[model samples]
Target: MSVFMVERDLKGISMDDLAGAQKAAIKTAAQMSDKGDKISYIRSTFAPEDGRCMCLFDGESAEQVQRLNDEAGLPYNRVVTALDLTP
Candidate 1:
């Protein structure tokens, strides 16, 4: 699976809501995977100062990642193919 980054603008969002969004992403990814879709929520980075959030996921394609976010009701500016160079 390739990694994809979902960029979101969440200005003025509360911490609780941010956490909730994360949970929703995870839950939705799991549900999709259970249904035979090869997708998983990897992690997220949120810059509270700018309300910019980037979520990472492992999936078969960018379209799959987009669908996951859409089903989770998560708002994203864009979804793009990304390289996860975590050593």
Candidate 2:
């Protein structure tokens, strides 16, 4: 699996809505995995001051990651291949 980053510009979005989006991503990913699509939500980062959000996922391709966001009804600026340099 490869890491993908989903970038979003969600200015003025409320906390409740942000949490709901996160839940949706997680649930949608699990459902996709159950149906044989290998995808998983890794983590998310948000800059509330500007409402800039980035979500990370593990999947086969950037298209797969984009599809996951679309299925979850999440808004993203782009999905791109990423390096998970987390320590």
Candidate 3:
């Protein structure tokens, strides 16, 4: 599986909405897994000061990550393959 970074621009998003989005992501990812589509939500980072959010997912491909977000009805700007650099 490839890791992906999903970006979203949601200005003035409330905490409640963010919580809901996380919930949706988890549910959708689990459903996808049940259907034999390997997708896992790693975590999320939010820069509320800039109204930007980034979600990390490990999946088959970037397209799968995009589909996962779409199925969750989460508004996102883009999904790109992510490479981890650990020292």
Candidate 4:
């Protein structure tokens, strides 16, 4: 599996929306696992000022991550493969 970043643009997003999206992502991850696929939601970075977000995930491919987002009804602008660089 590889890491991916899903980008989204949401203006004036409420806390409730973020919480709901997070929960849906978790459920989608579990569903993927049940299907024998490895996909997980790592975390999300929100930029309220910019009305944008970057959601981190680990999955087989960018497509898989996109699929999960779609299944969960999560709104995203794009999905890109990511390289984790930890200090």
lDDT winner among the candidates?
2
Task: Tell me which of candidates 2 and 4 scores higher on lDDT.
Answer: 2
Per-residue lDDT of candidate 2, residues 1-87 (tens digit): 999999999899999999999999999999999999999999999999999999999999999999999999999999989899999
User: Model 3: which residue pairs collide?
Assistant: none
- Per-residue lDDT of candidate 3, residues 23-77 (tens digit): 9999999999999998999889999999899899989998889899988999999
TM-score of 4: 0.93
Off by over 4 Å in 4: none
Model 2 clash tally, residue pairs: 0
What is the Å distance of residue 35 in model 3 from its true position? Answer: 0.7
Residue runs of model 1 more than 4 Å from their true location after superposition: none
- Name the runs in model 3 displaced over 4 angstroms: 85-87
After TM-score superposition, the amount by which residue 9's alpha carbon in candidate 1 deviates from its true location, in angstroms, is: 0.3
Sliding window of 10 residues with minimal summed lDDT for model 3: 78-87
TM-score of each: 0.97, 0.98, 0.94, 0.93
**How many steric clashes between backbone atoms does each model show?**
0, 0, 0, 0
RMSD of each: 0.5, 0.5, 1.3, 1.0
